[model samples]
Target: MTRSSNAPLSVVLAGGGSAGHVSPLLAIAHAIKATVPEAAIVAVGTKDGLETRLVPAAGFELAFIDRIPFPRRPSLDLLKLPMRMSRAIATAKSILRDANADVLVGVGGYVCTPMYLAAKSLGVPIVIHEANTKAGLANKVGARYTTFVGTAFAATQIRHAHLVGMPMRKAVATLDRAAERAAARERLGLDADRPTLIVTGGSLGALRINKAVAASLEALAAAGIQTLHITGKGKAVETASGELLTAPLYQQREYVDGMEDVYAAADLLLCRSGAGTVSEVAAVGLPAVFVPLPIGNGEQARNAAELVAAGAALLVDDASLDAAWIAENVIPLCKDDLRLATMGESAKHLGIRDAAESMAAMVLAASGK
Candidate 1:
């Protein structure tokens, strides 16, 4: 019944689909390795998620699980839920038994439900991490079975939640923008001395945000600011004449591989207020103008709530984000170094630099290590 104290900890982590889930999962795994060098770590994900690529790339063994999407309303999928859950639970039991799993960690995804169920049956301790202000269904179900639940946001509504902040990559957690700004700017072909602004809507980009940035390009350039706009795949900004918009003092890319570099080089950021973006920006102490995506139950707004309240960031509605708004708000803010520094300091004060280590310690404790 007790985890073997002499044995290396065997941990099974479940949660994957988007970068939001996978990125923190990887960060936690790395932190666990840092703490217990000989710990055996395995990730549970679906065959089609970003985890399929990211998990192995991070040098962890990834176990595939059936994707069981929860039905929001009455549907055929809901009718077959019993049989599907039974099969997935059986699969999860097999995975845990084979890995000799001492503890199961769920990070709020579809893959986590079955893992939580299986772990509960096997008497394996469960640790849950909810990354959003509002808990997801999977985490809600997982939370009922264990008390070691951690949250990225203090406002997150989870059972027995402890504030552990967001587990972010070490690159971002350890970044010193002041020390790396010049080199990062040089690498991106930006002027080292000039104020730089970056606009990103994450991997797939945000069309409305891209368009708004495009419309305000002239104003930003006129303010002696350089821009790096990552316009997601196939969502390129075009000119009035129907060609790709390639203006001077502005750079555009479909995506950038290493975002930490962009974070380091930028003087200001204009981005959507996803949990990952909010956490990373705060961790790097990057002053930002967050345009909370005007969708999905206002969780994005909630994610930026603490930072905005602390004067570390501004939250603009998606509809209010236009050329004029950018000109009036972002342009002026980007040029005010004293204000930016103060905001950055406020953000750093709120950012949790050791969340991964904290979560890792939580995992080790639950494993009886």
Candidate 2:
């Protein structure tokens, strides 16, 4: 609202808590910089959130505000909500003013609620990107005040929503998996000529996935497949007898920075179906078996629904993802070269590669500068 049409734009982006929120938020920031080289991009987040580390690392100025979470049930915390919200909104207002924010872009988190309310009161243009198939409470509240809304999935129930897909880091958005495969395999120490599966349970790891993969490792090795199993920080797949379970063809890694190498080296991805993971995997055309975490209103399952229906990915219940399921479904899928190729093609067809640019344009347009 402060910038004129010919002047460089100033944008405030708010999203925090999880990497799911921060990843897409950073992608949008990168896109905005690409389009408007002089644009002032200020990211607002709680000090306690991942943004403290991630935003500064990504070369953006980060501002902090108090987090005011909505209570789910009747409690004394609910009674104290107004005072907390007021303080957070006041802090958000200061950040917007300091940045001369013409537009406030929110990817939805506890940080966004205060920022959205502050932006509404200050008459700054609001643009929102909801990443989940089912909108979160913070984004739902934001949608009520802003017509400029974009979503990762088609079925997100926000008023005047645009299905612009998830914003991806430029590296991931433009990845050429087939072309990068050889070097990527080399980088990950994977066999370049062998069929490969990458199983990642994310940073905190999935106990069910790690256990199942550990149990099925011998079978995977017999079928001539190599695996890069990411067990998360300080966690690993262990035997029932409390022994570290590993195989010769199986590699255990704690994490992969940037994720491009892992994606390129993978013939198939076995992971959870969080919105960011689903969007990234589909965009990269990696055939996948999605194990949606069975929590939070079943949104993860919904996030994977489109790809699963397209045969780009397969979905299985979290409870059903055991050794038998991996052997019966995953091993056979990994062994089928023709099927993997088919699924990769299907995934590529459904992916929107330009989402970062598109979302950037949407936010810029809403700035009215």
**Candidate 2's C-alpha lDDT?**
0.90
> How many collisions between residues are there in candidate 2?
2
Residues 47-105 of candidate 1 have per-residue lDDT tens digits of: 99999999999999999889998888999999999899999999999999888898999
TM-scores of the models, in the given order? 0.97, 0.96
- Global lDDT scores for all candidate models: 0.91, 0.90
Clashing pairs in 2: 1-102, 5-369
Q: Measured by TM-score, how close is model 2 to the native structure?
A: 0.96
Candidate number with greatest lDDT: 1
- Tens digits of per-residue lDDT for model 2, 112-194: 99999999999999999999999989999999998899999998898779999899888888999999999999999988899
Residue-pair clash count for candidate 1: 0
